[model samples]
Target: MTFSSSYLFSLTTFIYMGAAALYLIHWIFRVKKVGFLATVVTVGGIVIQTVGIGLRWIESYQLGYGHAPLSNLYESLVFFSWVTIVVYLIIEWQVKQRVIGAFATPFASLSMAYASFSPNIEDKIQPLIPALKSNWLIAHVVTCFLGYASFAVACGLGIMYLIKNRFSGASEGIMGVIPDCKILDELIHQTIVFGFLWLTLGIITGAIWANDAWGTYWSWDPKETWSLITWFVYATALHARFVRGWAGRRIAYISIIGFASVMFTYFGVNFLLSGLHSYGAQ
Candidate 1:
């Protein structure tokens, strides 16, 4: 990548960190201006990140190899964080709530920062390996990360729900900044539903890709297994909420557990286990 492009990526990381801090402070102090500033900084970071991705693509072509940045763990993680922030911003705009952004922004920023700065992670735009040289690569990776991002948002809402539920009868000032427990629970459920739909599509597309590349629809790879485990957790949450008439604290706790599985699917599988998706490790 060009020096300028790397610089832009660095700047984007810093901006996101600032935005995340602003969001957290807003939640703690209930400052409207801090939330507004967080939104502004986040948008700025996204714009810079877009430019960085574009520059990396051009750099790949200049190196006589043309491929999307998604070919590597670092690039994929950066893109994952970018998509997470974008989706969180959209949800915040629609819901007119900033509390979730408090948690989401920090996590997103930290992930991006890790990708950008970690020496163990490779940031070069290398040619795609033969195993990954397929059209389905983009679809599979993008869809899965989108689902992961949505779940990350849901996880943030779930955390908020727990906090609000715990302080429902308390007179804490910070607790007052959170929404009602019922509203928090509803928001968590809605975000999880959104995540579940995307995750289903991601897994289906990945299955098709595996079939095309390896002539098998399922191999129970570590990544695939963890993803299935995550799906089951969320599915159980849905069943509990709808069939068992569970809501509020129980549902919030389930979402927390489900999102923990989501984290394992995204990070734990790569770092702690062996798999075909080891390219996702960083």
Candidate 2:
């Protein structure tokens, strides 16, 4: 009768997987009911995952750490999955489309899967380090992951646009369920702009936190350096879209590229490089 954080998280992972599978089936078979069911499953996954995250936060307190569940790779991955679902659902609601779930929910599912099953990631709660003790921890992590989640949704939309365009006439079976390329393109641009703003806030808050913790706002650490790089990549994407009148495949390409940068800034820097933010690798 008792559900621990781990138990709920494990259950949520399977729920996301089911959502992803249902979305894919809906997309491939053009089943309207399946699409509706997919949305329901995704919503269910989000609710359960939200409760699981809350339980984990409480468990941390029980363990004497008393911190938000955003400390280590396992926790970050878990929160990242949650935020990605939230961002995707908002887009689905605005566009009145469920097809994007095929592309978007998989990102959430994979994130949760990795967090729950990865051998290298530890799900145990630990006390925050001196630097992470600041209140900015929540703001910085939340904003950064929100931005990351938005970019992830944009990337999914971009992929959807490309698929719809690529199989325009020949593969009606697959493309028929997808939205128009124009709509996908517009959504991609809108999501990119949203992500860019959040990423900017994330970087700003991180700098403030860094200054408070390390006496410098800009240390050019590996993580900080890569974060700046990732920012510029998206900035250039937006600049090209706005000034050059670039849209369609160009913007789609940039969305994919920008997400690659985001992945690097998030995972690569944490694992492959060393920096003040290396505590995140824990």
Worst 10 residues of 2 by lDDT: 238-247
lDDT (CA) for every model shown? Answer: 0.84, 0.90
Model 1 ranges with Cα > 4 A deviation: 1-3
Error of 1 at 269 (Å): 1.7
Query: Per-candidate RMSD vs. true structure?
Result: 1.7, 1.3
Tens-place lDDT per residue, model 1, 138-215, is 898888888888888888888888877777886568888787887787787888888888899889999999999999
How many angstroms is residue 278 displaced in model 2 relative to the true structure, after the best TM-score fit? Answer: 1.0
| Candidate 2 clashing pairs, residues 3+ apart or interchain | none
TM-score of 2: 0.97
Q: How much is the lDDT of residue 48 in candidate 2?
A: 92
